[model samples]
Target chain A: MSAVWSITKKELVSYFTSPIAYIVIAIFILLSGFFFYSLVWWFNTQAMQMAQNPYYFQQININQMVFAPLFHNLSIILLLMLPVVSMRLFSEEKKMGTEELLFTSPVSVIQIILGKYLAALIVLLAMLVLSAIPTIFTFVHGNPEPVPYLLGYLGLFLLGAAFLALGIFWSALTENQIVSAVLTFGTLLLFWVLSWAAYSARGLWQDVLNYLSFFEHFDGMTKGILDTSDLVYYLSFAFFGLFLTHSVIQFRRWR
Target chain B: MIETEQLTKKYGDLVAIQNLSFRVEEGRIWGLLGPNAAGKTTTMRILTGYLPATSGRASVAGYDVFEQAEAVKQSIGYLPETVPLYPEMTVESYLGFVAEIKKVPAARKKAAVDRAVQIAGLQSVRKRLIRNISRGYKQRTGIAQALIHNPRVVILDEPTIGLDPAQIKEIRDLIKSLKGEHTVMLSTHILAEVKEVCDGVVIINEGKLMASGSLEELARSFSQNDGVYLKLDRADGEVLNLFRQLPGLKEAALDGAEIRLEWPWGQDLRTQVLKLCLDKRLEIREMRSLAMNIEELYLRIVSGGMEQ
Candidate 1:
């Protein structure tokens, strides 16, 4: 475990030494800020008459207006940002031959895999933390409930971890970082599009295919209902991706 | 110490190496001599735990490379055909990372890295990023990484492959200096480099062990009946008659002032030749045995194509 952490620490340092980390963080924050401002402007314009309807407005909760869109807009922000962090995790090392040094070291294979995974996870965590500015800014306009924000962040974290695992698995499959990035984006886009298809289906297939939707789990989180099944599903998804990555590593060594 | 028995590697239908066997004892530099695709690098990879043998066993530093790989890795430092290095890192940081991965004691890591830097003559480029350094410096950095942990055995695959003559001499001297402290096995196709540096030569050809012995011993075994060239102040016919008078002298050929003579094995023809020259009062300017050099011995072993 210490060996794994050591490698993770080294990878994090490597990220900072390169320009990829700052670029990913900058793009992520810029996109998140763009989404937050767009949602605020749209909601404020729609509820402009609430300024004069004092009686019903006082009775209505302002938290819904302030925090609801913040939670809703996070998915798209992450969809674009996560791949930037995860794309170069294994692909660049393979291209540079640094993977040989890592693999042949005294450290176990699990340590090397988990180290790369954790480095990308840390970068993601940093991105999520940066996106919290909008949630904090909601308190200036109106008293927003923190529960939904907390729940939304949890769902994003899990989703990001799952996406990162998929990215890492793809990174291990090839030596070209651009190919890894494009393929990861295509895969995540496929998943992102699946929820709409599942929702639009009219038959029993809709019920069956909806389980494959990442958005369905986000819906439960935004509603502040943390379903145990959703948590289990995301955890299993991440573990399955990691398992495939391990198999890829083992196959490289054996064959 | 190192030993291999019937070690083989095949890529598709092409065998990279096959049925190779040899033993390298401690306290000597063994040169693995073969052509570019002659499986020298493949054999080194198997010994260093980087690749597995297709059909045999290789043990290095008393650990079976396939079965006890971690142990083999711990005991050996391997420099691959391409010096696997991180070009983005400085020399100090690169060696530090090597020490960290090799698990040098925390208390001694800095000192070990320092010693390796000094030994490989990397002090000048210690603070420079590896990408900024020249190929010679990069090669030395590779050597420093291999020597960081001070493993019992060091295996270098074509360590001096791309260096200029001066850089090659520097690296050769460094390899020679590693003699008593570590058992070193280096591979090269340059015959002169092997003769100049290696205490023992192991020649392979077409993925098989052609011969293994000391340079002189291999030369003697492969080139048993050698000739002697005598340059003296004597006419061709007189020297031919003098050479024929000697009983064990097989044949004599004259080329201007030089007389070449071949003799049977274990014959003392030198004394007889000297006596004849003295009797004829021939002024002998030079009389020396023409033993086979490394190039001839390597060709004789490799092109002879014998399995032994």
Candidate 2:
């Protein structure tokens, strides 16, 4: 356990000691703030116009206007940014030859992979915390639903954990950080876009696909529903990716 | 002690090493001598548990390299040809990471890093980032990372390959200082390093062991006899011819005013040569026996007598 903690702390320190952590956080917050401000401003203007109307129009559906799109946009922003933050987790070490140093040590392959994965997870968590700043507007300026906000964050955390694990696996497969970043971005894009593809298609098979869609589950979190199945799905995704990463590193030892 | 029985490594159709069998007894520094691409790094990698052999068993410190690789890795500290370091990390932080991964206790980790830094003469640069340090300092950092855990066996591959003469001497001396407490297996093309620091030398060529023994034993086995050089005042062909025809002299060559005579066995031919020179009235400036140096003997064995 000390070995794992040692590697985790070392990786975490490396993340903060360089400009990468701050740069990634800056970009993530900047993009997320731009999207959040635009959405909330447009929705708040429409609500103001509805209040001034001579005829009532169901009070402009303010709850969905504030929480529903916030959840959706937050998920998309995280999907785009998490891959960039996680791309260097193992790829840089493999490129720099430090992978051999780690492999030759007495620590098992499990400890090394898990340590690096957890550190990247922590960085993603920090990004999640930063994303909450824009979400604070929903509570102060509009009708606040703390339940949905907290649950949506739980969903975002789980989703980002899953993506981070896959990103780590991709990073381990190559020595080039750009290749890892691009591949991870491509994989996340597929999952993000496929959720809508399944939602649009109308068939029995499509219904099954929509249920499997990442957004289908993430949408529940936006509504403040703690679905056990979505939790299982995201957890399994993270677990399997990490499992494959462990096996890949072990296979590299024999070769 | 370390032992490998027919350890082999094959990458696709290319065989890096085949049937490499050797042993290093406890408390000795063994040199793995080979030219480039002769499987020195491959052999070290197998022993370090970085790569598994295609067929055969390697046991280090009584643990099988394949079956008990974790134990083997615990016992061995390996410095590869290209030392992998985190450029962003300071020398102290890097060594601390190594000690941690190698399972040095937390209380002792600081002392372990300090000891390795001291041994590699890296105290002055301990706080500097690895990327900013000199190449020699980087190489020393590599050594320090490997030695941080105080493993029973230390393996270095081409430890002094890219260093300047001074750095090379410093690293060689560092390896020399590690003689008794640790069993070291260092591979290098510098034959003189083998003679200076190694207790036994293992020579490999074309992925096979050409010879394995101490320097003197190897020289004695391959060289027919120690050659004798005689610098004479007279440089006549007739004098060289007469010296070649003397009893117990197997061969003789003349270069300028010097004559080199080979004797197959240790016969007291110096008296005969002196008497012949006196009778011929030729002045002898210098006469000394020249034993074959380690380089020539190593080349002769590895190349099977072919030389440029």
Candidate 3:
């Protein structure tokens, strides 16, 4: 456990020492802030126009009007940005020859992998925390339900973790950071469009594609529905990605 | 402290190291001598548990490299051919991280780092970022990282490879100083390095072990037939004939007032030649017996002059 923390500390220090952490966090905030501002603007315009109608105005819940769409937009932004955060985790180690040192140390492979994964997750968590600052305005000015709003953030975090795990798997495949980032983006994009493909399909194929799609599992969480099935899907996706990464690293040693 | 038996590694069809075997007793310095692509790096990687062998057994500090890898890793410290370092880390922090992972107790981590820093002469650059330091200092920092845990066996692959002469000397001295406390195995293609620092040598070429023994044992075994150089004031053809007439003198040739003689090993012909010189009234200016240095021994063994 101490070995895992040692690797995590070293990785965190490296991320901050370089410009990568600050740049990624800054870009995420800028983009999420833009999305939040535009969504709130649209929500205000609709709320004002519907003021004369009692029934429609009563249905104008801030949770549905502003926060839901914002959470969905934040997930897209995370999908685009988390790859950059995870691209260098393993690629830089192989390129710089530091993998030899890590493997030859007393630590196990699982420990090293978890340490790096946790560091990237911490960076993801920081971005989520900073982006929440804009959401705090909704709580102060309007009466948005706190439970569903927090659940949306939880959904975003799980989705981001799943993205990071796949990114880490790609990073372990090659020594070039650009290659790792592009491959992660391409694979995530494919997973994103699986549900679109499911729309044209029929029967069991549609059900399978919908189940495998990253979009389906995240939908319930944004609506404040705590389904065990969605939780299982995200956690299993992350575990499978980490398992593949471990196999890749272990295979290289024998080869 | 370290031993390998029939250690073999293959990548698909190409064999990196084949049936290689050697040993390093406790408190001794052994050199793995081979030229480029001689599987020196492959052998070191296998013994360090960074790579597994296809077939064979290896152990470090009484722990099998494959079966008990964690124990073996904890007991040995290795510096790969390329010094692995994080450029963003300070020398001090890098050693501290290594100590932590190497399982040095929390209370003693700082002391271990300090001891390694002092031993590797890294005090001057301990606080500086690794990328900002010189190459020599970076190499020393790599050495410091390896020693921070104070393991029983320290394996370094080409430790002095890219340093200047003075830096090489300093690194060599540091390696030599690890003799009594740590069993050290260093790999190099430079014969002079083996001569200078190593007590024994394991020579390999093309992934095959050519020879392994102490320096003197190798020299003696390969230099069974010795030679002598005689410089005299009057080394005419008649003097050469007189020297050649002595029994057990294999061959004597004259060239410009000098005569060269060859004889079997362990034969002392100096007195007989001196007697002949005195009887012939020849003035001997210089007389010396030629002893084989590491260069000749290494060349002979690597060039296939001696059978495996």
Candidate 4:
């Protein structure tokens, strides 16, 4: 609908025109390049040492040994950067009082949430594309399976979508951008680190906590396994975040 | 048209508006006058579909505010107290976005934005970012954004509250120009604005309606008698005594060179008072009817000096 497009375009314009987008992209690419270069360099040195012995039984596939770890490291980098990128989605609107125009407009609340969340998704997509430069060098310099790297990228995209949605949820809950960013980071960190606590637990509780961890599925996708359950988990997680955001905005109308 | 029946909005334990009701007929400029904390904005928010009322029913442009909110929103343009705007956007782009969200068709969006910019007199600063414009221009941009949709009903909350005198007059004239084509309701604490621009007014205080009628009707309903003021060159005790003899004279008081007298309701003692001054050889310096204006009526009503 035109209403959603209008808001989405406006939000995208705001994001790119300011220095926030440029700074976030710059930082994400810089960190991702460092990790990628280090991972590939380390993988090469390990491969060379193994070449010294022709009787080595285990094979070192460059995709898993190098590019998979690169994807995993870049996901961690996105975890730190995406929250800041999405922090202004609704918090800035509240700070600027533009929420009044939004609420009074004929546009539905879901359209607004979707529009803003999509714009953040676009920003993350841009970061992913730009950061893929170093990975492209991996293909030119060495033979890495394309499907595995693509799967890792897909997994990162899904995780980024869910993280950005949750960031927007936090942004809608407050008018302070820093508070939104901080809270988003805290919540996402809990999901990323929850698997660590599973190690100390036993039986069903451990399995439940491990399954709840976002990386549990992200790790599976990074290894080139396209599981439907993992895809459903990430999609449903993003939907639940979006649903809560829509409800928060609707509830404010009653106040 | 806009109508409400016993509309009430409560913020938890505090009642923002209580059992308030009023109507805005088609294509008329109406004023909602109240002091600070009088729930003017709260009422406007409900009508604009920005906030839901706690109780009772309200409708805008024939659509229920709560049930048919999307329809109501599509038919109304709202300018809030804070003048909601994206400071980063240009005036032209901001109006364009408003037009788009208000569902103006693709082919007509440019024309709609241009019309709104012209109506708000924002042509000179159409390309300027909202953050860089002056306060008056920003206010006009707010009005332009509200009117871009060309809704039948437009609600502006304190459109001239923080503007300079020149800006205030300009904005008032802009609102007055919409008398016949667009139904407008502007809330303000300035009584003179209502008298100059509004065809009818709804005065409230502490979230309750004090009076709702045209200027003359409200004044007449609050006053016991019509009043007049006369300044005579020789306004001595004898001059006051001569004026008291006029027919329909209810009460007469002389203070310095000014003599203000009250007469029976709907009585025009102007000719009689003039004839008496001519007969007594009293030179009249200044003479004007001091019919109870909106200022006194509002003070009297809000202060509970008049019976509701």
DockQ of each: 0.45, 0.66, 0.79, 0.76
Please, what are the lDDT tens digits per residue for candidate 4 over residues B1-308?
98999999889999888898888899999999989999999999999988989998999899999999999999999999998988888999889899988999999999998899999999899999998999999999999988998889999999998999999999999999988899999999998999899998988888888888778877777667887788887666776777777777988888666898898776788888888889878887888767777787788888973435
lDDT of 4 by residue, A72-132 (tens): 7888888899889989999998998889899899999988988888888889899999989
Taking chain B only, the TM-score of every model is: 0.87, 0.82, 0.85, 0.89
Docking class of 2: medium
Candidate 1: where is the Cα deviation over 4 Å?
A: A46-48, A54-68, A200-208, B225-228, B233-289
Write one digit per residue (lDDT tens) for candidate 2, span A67-155: 67866787887777778877888889888777878888888888988899889888888887986786676677666667877887888
All candidates' TM-scores? Answer: 0.89, 0.88, 0.93, 0.94
Candidate 4 residue pairs in clash (backbone atoms < 3 Å): none
Interface RMSD of 4: 1.1
Misplaced by over 4 Å in model 2 are: A50-63, A137-143, A199-204, B224-290, B305-308
Q: What lDDT score belongs to each candidate, Candidate 1 first?
A: 0.83, 0.84, 0.91, 0.89
Q: Kindly state the number of residue pairs that clash in model 1.
A: 0
Q: Candidate 3 on B1-308: residue-level lDDT in tens? A: 88899999898999988898888889999999988999999999988899999999999889999999999999888998889999999999999999998999999999999999999999889999999999999999989888999999999999999899999999999999999999999999988999999999999988889989888777668666677789988777787888889999888997556788878877878889899889988888998665578888788888964546
Query: On a 0 to 1 DockQ scale, where is model 1?
Result: 0.45
Best by lDDT: 3
Q: How far is B104's C-alpha from truth in model 4 (Å)?
A: 0.8
Candidate 2 at B188: error in angstroms? 1.8
Residues B1-308, model 1: lDDT tens digits: 99999999987688999999998889889999987789998888888776777889899989998898888888888787778777767889888878887778778989999999999999888999888999999999988888999999999989999899999999999999999999999999988899888999888988989999787677667655667889986657866886787887788888667888887556657887888889888889898776787888887788878767
Residue B226 of model 4, lDDT score: 84
Q: What docking class should model 1 receive?
A: acceptable
